[model samples]
Target: MHVRNKSLTPLCGSSRVARLLVPSAACTLALSLSVWSSGAAAQAQGPNPPPLAMGLIVKLKESQTPSVVRLRPSVRPSDAAPSQRARLYAAANRKRVGFLIQKPTAFGAHVIHSGQFSSVDEAEAEAARLRQDPDVAWVLVNRLEQPLAGRVNTVAVPQSGGVYDDHFWLKDRTARPGVARFATAWGRIGANRSVAPVVTAVLDSGVLPNDDFSGRLLPGYDFVSEAQYARDGNGLDSDPTDLGDYLTSGEKQSNSAFSGSSCQVGNSSWHGTMVTSMLAPPAGSGFFGPGILAPLPGAVVLPVRIGGVCGAAISDVIEGMLWAAGIDYQGSPPANPNPARVINFSYGGSGTCRTGSATDTLYRQTVTALESKGALLVAAAGNGDGSVGVVGPIMPANCDGVVAVTALRKDGTKSSYANLIDGSLSAGYLGIAVAAGEFVSGSPGVTENLHLISDTGASTAVARYIRPDVDGTSFATPQVAGAAALALAVNPGLTVPALRQLLRDSATSYTNTYTTYAGSAPLCSSVNRANCRCDTGTCGVGVLDADKLVELALDLATNSPQPDFSAPAVAATSFVPQRGNGSLAGGGGGGGGGGSLEGVSLLGLLAALALGLRQRFKSGRP
Candidate 1:
């Protein structure tokens, strides 16, 4: 909301004790005694007259008692009159200062006491003058815009590889065996061993300590409050209450008035924990049986708790962004000392580009700032069932300078809920899609520690492990985030924008008719038809290929142009506008279908494989 000046006025009054001691008090007492003596006069006067004005509290002196005063406008009123009133009060009470607080008709501004003026008019004039200063971003009054206070509820779910199980994508050779092969090839070629430890920040619901992520978690703060929201004084807050669906709750679940009772931490699902585990697990833990990312053995996972147990307000999310990017907090300058090079945001809200809203502006600023700092911000494209280009990209993924990611199934088709990018749009708006994982059908694995709800609304806290199927855009985001980290590990000097461009430029190209995963049943029935074509922009440069990205980064670092890493050349006649959609029509296209084949030829492939083995040995990967 925006706040403007002209809504505030200076307050004027006299010292309270002086008024009571004046001759007026004696006269009042005499009149009261006379009225009591004459009953007829008291009856004629009716009830005692109401107070001239509401009593106002004012500070007098250290030993002096507080005095009640009435608000009164200063004589000789003018635009400058309020300043005069302020001057009077300032003089009367040596310790008191007066300010004219202005209220804005819209959005709140940064609250500040611009300056003190001698007269009410003078203060008003100064406010007006400050408003004209270009450097004065905003002038807010002395009022508080408090969000309804409430407790945040956190629900815990088992750390199963749900619908987007990474194991399926990593182990299954039948499905896009290419992705699995890429993983294996990446391990063998890039550096048979893991590279330097890359820190990845998961800015989502607060991550709890689990057997899966013990020592890997780093120290982080809760921007939600000064209190202990991250953990209680004793230990990790462990209230495991399950909250009903937000959309399905009736009168009992209305959050209209922020109440702490309805929102208790540790009473919700474990969405954040599972997502974090996917990116960085504890030293020896695994969600899908026992496989681990070769490079993750020494990696550190920084958990920036932005999302609350249930949900997060836009402000908290913005603060989380700034903190994650090592930006200033509460007027402090940027001091992350050790910032994470990769940021994973696996959550999004439904909204197109509405520039003026608080969420949009803050997001734009935060994303732009982070990108300027060389951190790749990877975000989920959202699970909404709208067309890729039209559903409006979920922000900050949709925000310029961010890597917007969508989800793909085992068959190379876009997930019904994943948002797609329009290839026809500018490169800034384009997004990439990748394999999320397999969807776990039925109650595959159940552990006895957690409770599962039966069809009849009964909850049983049994040691059951339900294997989840990986299907949402949430699962797909981490794959790209992890790949981006690998890219940075190869070339840490890459800027945020450059990394995004590299990812897009290096994406493999293909053609397939895109279909909505959440649309009409008829579309699903025709999934077997080859008529559905997948092409560039249709399936976001095809699933992410790590080997090609590393090679590109290596080329960038060495300043030597690798033939396979060469970018497409634009036709001389193609008008490349300074800031418009410009297309690169020719040049050997990027990795075809899955990735570039130029580097895969017998000799080149063998050499690249050898280099990968050398890197693995250097990086300490097994």
Candidate 2:
């Protein structure tokens, strides 16, 4: 029989009565009296309570004390034994057993089974007991739900694999051609092919099979609902499947496009194909040349498809990122037979920074977890032209432990659309910039473009040099991602922070100047590049210098006891700044094709003039 404690109602709630009764009645009464006395004393002491009792003891005379009473044990055969109680308590406290529940149905919770009960009597008894409490929902005992398996393998896109061809020209050669020459020089320095094999996970459109990428693609999972076709009972597709984009606008609404015939076929834009090609093109593919510089020839490519034809949900993308980096999915992790060493995210969204957003939190947690496992994350800086650069650096990239990349034109000048760093902005913003040869000049030849047609038989617009003058930061990200693969190849143990520093320290410095087209020019000369220093404002660690980076990595790998590459100061600001507003005019209108010549014409002239002046100054003949 249970009796409600009337006096305790205003003090301890009904739920806690059972707990209070566990102690003796006299003890409970004493504790209550002590609490009441303390409150009264605090009031008398003018609001502040007196110090707690140090050595006070409650003493009762023998006459005043109640006589000790002994009662018969009330044990029943049906009652649980002490050992059984202990086992139940242990199971209740187990972290994995508890199912996270919510009032309304929201996602992100898992259910676990405590094994089948022998009879409904036991199951009903548990359910009735738990239902009486507010925290616990009905505890139904039934067959457990099957666990969802995550994709672990990835396949490389056929024909779409190779190192960046530095031969492509941009801006009619107004800046220095040193980057290309540097790549060539680095190749000759015994450092050629010194890169270690690195696994790079591509979280984008699905990959299609081709003869060019034989034995290169690893098995991967497609999370997009439409790509359910790529999903096999074992988890991911065994064969490479074509993936298309979902149009965000037009006749097809959100769910409307999937039913059409065109919806079933993949689009020919080949954004993912283009990006992978730049990083790891097949060997002996004359499309680019005899070979491209891929540090990890045997490095596995894990294609976790999060983005769909049109775009992808932030949640889906986050899950893909976490899964690719070997984070558990929905509370369970796969065997992770082939975990990625580096994750390449070439896509982004237009969103502001916020604390609790799913995208932001997931990105932060994912990066921290991945880095702890010795994996590095590389993301595109985005194509938006906002003041802060790429919309808060777009999750994961903007997150603390990940490296963000911005694009550079062939002339070594930051692309106009590329995000810039301004002094007014805070630190920890803007992506590290790298040269992604101009889109127009780097377009594959007409014959090559025609030859590499998609399954749809439509000409890949990305492969064609249709827009002679258009530029975007989107085209520049792959250069940095590919470079990171090389860095990892040289030093497999390099941490995310160390890799970022190494890239910055070994970067090539250039004079930063802001330029404007005929209609976009600002009147203030102070707004020009002369005022903006290279390593100061928007130019993050200047531009990437592959040769210096390879040298640094090799030095670290050989364990020569060199200076600490992990030191923040040495890593962040080692590159020297080039003085003056080094602007090259003429690629768009200055009357010449945008190519390496433009860079030579502008930077070469400055280099020669600087050399001649130094010689004259030394001779004292001026």
Best by TM-score: 1
Candidate 1 lDDT over residue span 1-622, tens digit each: 0000101100000011101111011101111112212211211211111111000111111111211110000001111223423433443234232333321111111212222112223333434444343323222122111111100111223555432233545443343522423354355334633355566777654554554555666665454321222222221122211111011133114432212122221122234544665666532454433222345555466676543322343444555665565543222223344466788876554443344433344455456546534467887765442111124345566776667776555455554434555455455565777655322223211210111111111111232333322234555677778777777666665656567767877665533222322222222112321112334444455556666676677678678322221111111111111111111101111121212233323333244345434434533478
Per-residue C-alpha lDDT of model 2 across residues 554-622, encoded as one tens digit per residue: 676677322222322222211111111211000011111111223333443344344434334533467
- Index of the highest-lDDT prediction: 1
The TM-score values for the models, in the order shown, are 0.54, 0.53
Residue 121 in candidate 2, Cα distance off native in Å: 48
Worst 10 residues of 1 by lDDT: 4-13
Off by over 4 Å in 2: 1-166, 169-182, 185-195, 225-240, 246-268, 290-295, 331-333, 353-358, 385-392, 421-430, 437-471, 512-535, 560-622
Residue 196 lDDT, candidate 2, scale 0-100: 53
Determine the C-alpha RMSD for candidate 1 after optimal superposition of all C-alphas: 23.3
TM-score of 1: 0.54
